[model samples]
Target: MSSLNTNTNIKSEIDIRKKANYKTEGSDNIRTKKQKKYVLIDGHVYDFLKRSFDIIFAIMFLMIASPVMLVVAFLIKLEDGGPIVHARICIGKNNREYKMYKFRSMIPNADQMFQLFTPEQMERYKVGAKFDDDPRLTRVGKFIRRISIDELPQLFSVVRNDMSVIGPRPVIEREAAAYGENRNKLLSVKPGITGWWQVNGRSDCAYLSDEAKNLQLYYVDHRSMGLDIKILLKTFKVVFYGKGAR
Candidate 1:
């Protein structure tokens, strides 16, 4: 009788353990489903169309802007004989690192000029990695930045499939921390030369602020062809007015 009792006790303990394991698995499945709700799934058709548009836009713009690019290159060379393009290591789609090119807009070795920053400038840089009245900007750099001309070189990146014409602007690896939990979602799509945030408020929205994170996530969540066209149209207005340019 005692043996039967011991056997019954063991069976009860095993049943309890099985129930606990089942509950744990159920909770995990629930959490996984919740995460899936946030995952962006750009269908194959959308991807193809977006890529086609990016290529067409980049080729046409490069042709039209070739002369302007040459002139800008000459001015940059004349100013300091430094590299005409500045390549920044930025976080791209799927958290890959890529060199994002821009017209060199600062003095050569500008990345190593942190020691020259005032305490105030250092604080500003910590916030957004940029500030007005930057001491590092050359004269041509200042003009190009103000007119958004420095960004023109990113067209090549678009052609290379490293970027899109419209998407979230790529952030440096350090800046990716600003997106917090949504960082993966932000990197799910290729970064862009212009984006929802760029046309909305650009530099006026502090990079580390909640507003900037929300704007970037909103684009990731709601990206569509219509919305892309809308952003492209608004970009012209923003660039023309130099809104939020520094």
Candidate 2:
């Protein structure tokens, strides 16, 4: 009986040692992976060229779009005598926070009036991050939103270096939680005015939904100057066709 007990003790010690070794190896593997590095592009040249492109095109677009922006601004103020733009605080590259520029498509007190929505409307807004029949929209707001003219002002962000001309869409800070382990990867490059997710399906895929995160992260992983150009061209089509603006 003593021999059996000794054997059982020995077996227990062996099992414990095996588990300890396994845990050590597991931790080592994770540490090794964490130490390895990845990069978005091959060289500094790509980054420089991308930034140059953003700057040049941002200037051009702003010059050309300024008149339209002014007209829209006038219409917004004429409607309700409210603010003309909405500078939403959003997450940018390296987890930097910046105010993303957009033409105002809601009433000036829109953020303060959430409780005015019906529970059903609030739920719908939460699901899509925008309400199709949002009460905050002024008459001018509906037109601009439907045609996506509201986002034209984001050229200012590109010019200001807060965003890229083409990359992943900037996300609200709270939405960062949904990226999970990929948050660092997503924030490695400047967010864009247009991107893979926008060209594929804008608000059709609700913000932070699995589908939206997958599309955004896919762009982050496989981004290139060539891909950016493709997205820019495709974005024109999506915008002109009013494919998924709502």
Candidate 3:
């Protein structure tokens, strides 16, 4: 499970992905829907039905969560008078970059405060790309994070067509290099707010480790509308139980 070969073209890439899938799962487990969806067009497998579902799901979630988002926004602002939404460039389909949004769950200028962390904490942060006991989190931030409320702002990204409702979670641009040859395959489809790895273990899986990499790759290789629906249903239970959240 090292990086894929660098010389692979679009068809070859798809072939390699299919071959990888076959090795990972028995042929009997291979779903035709997954195979049909990845015939690349201009370096992407456009699934209009999935995009349509994303649009509909985004609209419905927005409609249902608008009032709750407003309340969360007001509380965030009231706590420290800081920006309610945090935006950062995240890599999306075909290596395109877009601003991904989330509620600001940390103090303003938290990046600057990273220097204050102890060396051990900084080492952990570098390894995992997240802090198990983050000191920058605001009081309201801690609460919102525990219940997974901080991600509601990303519904806007979904509506804006920057992400799908169910797919691989987008990664920051700096983190994209780690994918190496798999980068193109990873970016061949739209990134999502939730997906297989997320529903399976969320933050518990070490970033860039085999567990995380394999899960993400498995999702990309074996993706289908049916798989997406299954992941979505599992996501609800994960959310309700607050499973694997930081």
Per-prediction TM-score: 0.81, 0.81, 0.80
lDDT of 2 by residue, 70-186 (tens): 999999989888889988899999998999878898888788998889998887677656657888888898899888889888988898999998998888877886788999999
Sorting all predicted structures by lDDT, with the top scorer first, yields: 1, 2, 3
93-164: candidate 3 lDDT, tens digit per residue: 988999999999999999889877888888867766455478889998988887889998888899889899
Sort the candidates on TM-score, descending order.
1, 2, 3
Worst 10 residues of 3 by lDDT: 37-46
In model 2, what is the error at residue 40, expressed in angstroms?
A: 9.8
- The local lDDT score (0 to 100) that residue 217 gets in candidate 2 is 91
Q: Which window of 10 residues has the lowest lDDT sum in candidate 1? A: 36-45
lDDT of 3: 0.83
Residue 83's lDDT within candidate 1 is 96
| Tens digits of lDDT, candidate 1, 1-246 | 999999999999999999999999999999898777545344666888999999999999999999999999999999999999999999999999888999999999998998889998998887784667899999999999888999999999999999999999788988897787888999999998899989886888877777877888889999989999999999999989998987
Error of 2 at 160 (Å): 1.4
Angstrom error at residue 174, model 1 = 0.8
Off by over 4 Å in 3: 1-46
